[model samples]
Target: MRKIIVIGSMSIDLVVSSSKRPEKGETILGDNFFTTPGGKGANQAVAAARLGEQVYLVGRIGDDDFGKEIYENLKDNNVLVDGVEPVTQMPSGTAHITIADQDNSIIVVPSANNEVTIEYVKKHLEQLDSGDIVLLQQEIPSETVAFAIEYCDRNGMISILNPAPYREVSNQVIESATYITPNETESNAMFKGNMEDALQAYPKKLIVTMGDKGAIYHDGNRKVTVDGYKREVKDTTGAGDTFNGAFAVGLQKEYDIEKAIAFANLAASHSVTGMGAQGGMPTLLDLEGEWHV
Candidate 1:
C-alpha cells in the first residue's frame, strides 16, 4: 500500500446535544454530552485507514489522558502513529462542539497542536515519496502546512489540502498543492464570490464539496460535478475528512481525478449515514462493497 502522510492536529472533542443554540448572553440545557477523539488530521487519518490506506500521522498532542485516548484510538484503527510528536509543554488540543438538530457549532483551544512547527514538519519530509499522498489541514499552523506542501512539491509527491475551519489561505500553499478540497462555506470563503475566480489563483486541481448536492471538480481547464450518494444523514462531522482521505487512497491507486472524486463522494455519502466523526467513515471493503466500480 502506498503511504498517506497527514499533517495536522490531534484533539479530544466534547459534544453536546441541544435543541437550540445559545442566544446572546443566554444559556440552554443540553440533552447529551460525550467526549471523542477528533481533530481534522486524526479524523482523516482514521478515515484513510478505514478505506484501507496506509496512513502516517504527524502532529502534536500533549501527554495527558485525552492525548492518551487519542493515541489508543489511532492504533486501534491501524493509523501509523510513529510520526506523531508528543509534547509535554502543553496539553492536548480540545474542541467543545454542540449539535443542534442538523446545525452544529464549535469552539477549539489549539493547545499542543498549535506547537506543530515547520521544524517538526521538515523533520518528517523524508517520509514522503513519489506516488505517495500527502494530506494537510488547518488544525495546525498555516506555516507548517505551507512547509509540508512545498516539501511534497519538491519531493514529487501528491499534495492534498483540506482547508477546514475557514481561515484565509496562503497562495503559496495553494500553488504547491495537487488538489484543494474545500467545503461550500470554505470554498466561498477561499474564492470570495466565484469558484472559478478562486480556482484560477492556484495551478492545482480544485475540489469543492457541497453537502448533499455532491462535489464539483476543476482541473485548471475542465469542470465536472460528481453527484452525491443519498443516505440518512445523522451527523456530518467527518464527511469532508472521509472524502479527502478516500480521495487520497484513490490517488495512491492511480485512479483518475473523476474516479477518485466519485470514490470520495461515495465514501462521504456512506459516512453521513452514521453519527460522530470516525464512527461514520466506511472501511475499504465497505466502500468497495457498497459502491462497486
Candidate 2:
C-alpha cells in the first residue's frame, strides 16, 4: 500500500460540555471538562494510522508539556513523527471547544502550528516517494498548504486537500489537488452557490459532505450520493477528519471512488458516536466484522 503523508497542525484540545451556551457576559456551570490531542492534521493522521495505513505526520509543536503530549499521542497511534519539529519560542497549539446538544464550537490558538512554513513542508515532502497520498488541511499556513499541494501535483503524488475552517484559497492550489473534500458550508464559501451548483461546477474534483445526509461525489460522468450510516451522535468534532482519512486509505488501497466514499461515510458515521476528535476514530479492529468493500 502507498504511504499516507499528512501535512498539518498538532494541538492539545481543551473541551467542555454544558447544557446550553451562555449569553454575552454570562457565566454558567459546565457538565464536564477534558483534554485530548487534536488538530485537523493530527486527527486525520491518527485516523488513517488507526485504519491500518502506514502514516507520517509533518508539523510543528512547542517545547511545552502539551507538545510532549501531542508527540506521545502520535507515536502511540503508530504515526511517524520524524518530520515533527519542536520550536522553543512558541507554546504548543491549542483548541478550546464547547459542546452542547451534540454540536460544538471551537476557538483555536495557532501557536507553534504557525511555524509550519513552506520550507518546512518542502523538507518533509522531499522524502516521500511518488504514488504516496498527501493529505492537507487549513489549520496551518495557507501558503504552506498551497505549496504542499502544488509540490505533490508536480511529483505525481495524489494530493487530497480538505478545506476546513473555510478560507480563500488560490486557484492554483485548488487546481493542484487530486481531490478536494469540503462540507456543505465550505463548498458554499468556495463556489458561491448552493450544493447542487457546486457539485455541477466541479463534478469530478470535489466531494461535498453533508452530515448525516451522507456525501456526494461526481466521477466526471455522473454524480453519486453515498448514504451515511445511522448512529446516535455524541460529538461531531472529528467526523470530517475521519472521513478524509478513511477516504485516503481507500484510495491508497485502490478502491473505486464510490466504494471509497462509502467506506469513508461509514467511518465518519461511526466517529460521531464517540467523544472528542482523535478519541472517536475507529480502528480496523472496530470495523473488522461490520465493514466490507
Candidate 3:
C-alpha cells in the first residue's frame, strides 16, 4: 500500500455543547465541555490510520501537555509520527469549538502550527518517496500549501489538497494538484458563479463535497454524484476530514474515481455518528469488509 503523508497542523480541540448560539455580548450556560486531540493533519492521519493505511503525519506541536497528548494520540491510532516535531517556547495550537443546534462553529488559535513552514516541510518531504500521496489542508501557511503542491507535481507524487477553512489559492497550485476536495461553502469561495462550471473546469480533479448530499465530480465525460449514507449524526466536525482521508486510502488502493468517492462518503457517514473529530472515524474492520475492492 502507498504511504499517505499528511502535512498540516496538530492541536487540541476544546468543544462545548449548547442549545443555541449566543447573541453579541450575551452569555448563556452551555450543556457540556470537553477536550480532544484534533487538528486537520492529525485528524486525517488518524482517519487514514484507522482505515488500515500506513500513514505519516508531518507538522508541529508545542512543548506543552496538549502536544504530548497529540503525539500519543497519533501513535495510539497507529500513525507514524517521526515527522512530527515540537516547537520550543510555543503553545500547542487549539480550536475553540461550539456545537449548537446540530452545527459547529470553530475559532482556531494557530501557535506552534504556524511553525510548519516550507523549510520544515521540505525536510520531511525529502525523506518521503515519490508516488506517495501527500495530503494537505489550510491549517498551515498558504505558501507552504502551495509549495507542497508544486513539490508533489515535480516529484511525481499524488497531491490531495483539501481547501478548508477557505483561503485564496493560486490557479497554478489548483491545476497542479491531483485532487481538490472542498466542501459546499469552500467550493463557493474557490470558484464563484456556477458550481457545475467549476466541476467541469477541472473534470475529476475537483471534488465538491456536499454535506449529507454526498460528493460530486465531473468525469471529463459527465458529472457524477456519489450519494451520502444516512446516519445518526452526533457530531459533524470531522466528516470532511474523514472523507479526505478515506479518499486518499481509496486512491492508494487504485480504486476508480466513483468508487473512491463512494468509499469516502461511506466513511464520512460513519464519522458523524460519534463525538469529536477522531472519535467516530470507522476502522477497516468497521467497514463490514466493504473496503476490499
Candidate 4:
C-alpha cells in the first residue's frame, strides 16, 4: 500500500456562527460558539484516514492542552503522528472562524506551525520513498512547501499541493508540483485571473475546485468538470480539505482523474452537512453504494 504523507500544520479551531457578518467596530450576537481540532493539514489527514487510508501527518503543535487535543484527535482518526511533535514554549496554532450565511471567514495564528522548518522536514524526509502519496498545504513555511515539491519530483513521489489561505505561489513551485489544487479565487490569483489559460497550460496537473458547483481540470484533450454532489449546507469550513484528502485516496486506488474528482466531490458534499471540519467526513463504508470505486 502506498503511504499517504501529509506535511502541514495542526491547530484548534475557535468557531462562531451568526446570521450576518459584523460591520467594522460593531458587535453582534452569534448563534453558537465551539472549538474543534482543525488545521488544513490535520483536517486533510483526518479526512483521508476516515476514508480508510493510513495517513501520516507531519507538522508541529504547541505544548499545550489544545495541542494535546489536536494530537488525540489525529490518533482517534487513525492518522499516524510519528512526524507530529510539540514545540515547547510555543502556543498551538489556531484558526478563529466566523460562519455567516453558510460560508466562513477565518483568521489563523500560525504559532507553532511556523516551526515546521526545512530542517525539521529533512529529519522526516528520509522515511519517504518513491510512489508515496504526499499531500501538502500552505499552512507551513513557504520555503518548506517549495522544498517538498522539489523533493517529491526528485524522489519520484507524487505530490498534491493544496494552495489555500491565499499565498503568492511561484512559477517553479507550480511546475514542480504533480498536482496543484486551488479554489476559484486562489486559482485566479495563481494565474492572474486567466483560469482557462491556466487550465490549458497545465492540463491534468491543475485542478480548480468550485464550491457546490464542482471542480474542473483540463484533461490534455479537453476541460473536464466533475459536478459536485448536492447536499444541505451546514458549515463549509473543511469541505475543501475533505476534497483533497478524498482525491488523494482516489489516486491511490488508481482511479482515473474523472473518477477521483467525483469521489472527492461526493466526500466534500457529505462534509458540509455537519458542523466541524472532520465531523461529517465519511468512512469508506459510508461511500459504499454511491462511490463507484
Q: Under the 3 Å rule for N, CA and C atoms, how many clashes does model 4 have?
A: 0
Winner on lDDT (2 vs 3): 3
* Per-residue error (Å), model 2, residue 64: 0.5
lDDT tens digits by residue: candidate 3, 1-293: 77899998888999999999999999999999999999999999899888757799999999989999999999999999989999997899999999998889999999999999999999988987878999999999999999999999999999999998889999999989999999989998889847789999999899999978999999999999999888887999989999999999888888888998999998999999999999899997789855556
TM-score of each: 0.95, 0.97, 0.98, 0.98
* Candidate 2 TM-score versus the reference: 0.97
Best by TM-score: 4
| Model 2, CA-based lDDT | 0.91
What lDDT score goes with residue 150 in model 1? 87
Better of 2 and 4 by lDDT: 4
Candidate 4 segments whose C-alpha is farther than 4 A from its true place: none
Per-residue lDDT of candidate 1, residues 1-293 (tens digit): 67889888889988888788888999889888888899989999998888766788999999999989999999999999988867999999998888887756778889999998998888887756686888999989988888888888888988999999879888788788889999888988888868876665553488888877888876677666788887877778888888988889888777888888888889988887776777789987776666766
For residue 292, model 1's alpha carbon misses the true position, in angstroms, by: 1.9
* Candidate that beats the other on TM-score, 2 or 4, i.e. the better one: 4
Off by over 4 Å in 2: none
Q: Per model, how many backbone clashes are there?
A: 0, 0, 0, 0
Output the lDDT of residue 213, model 3. 91
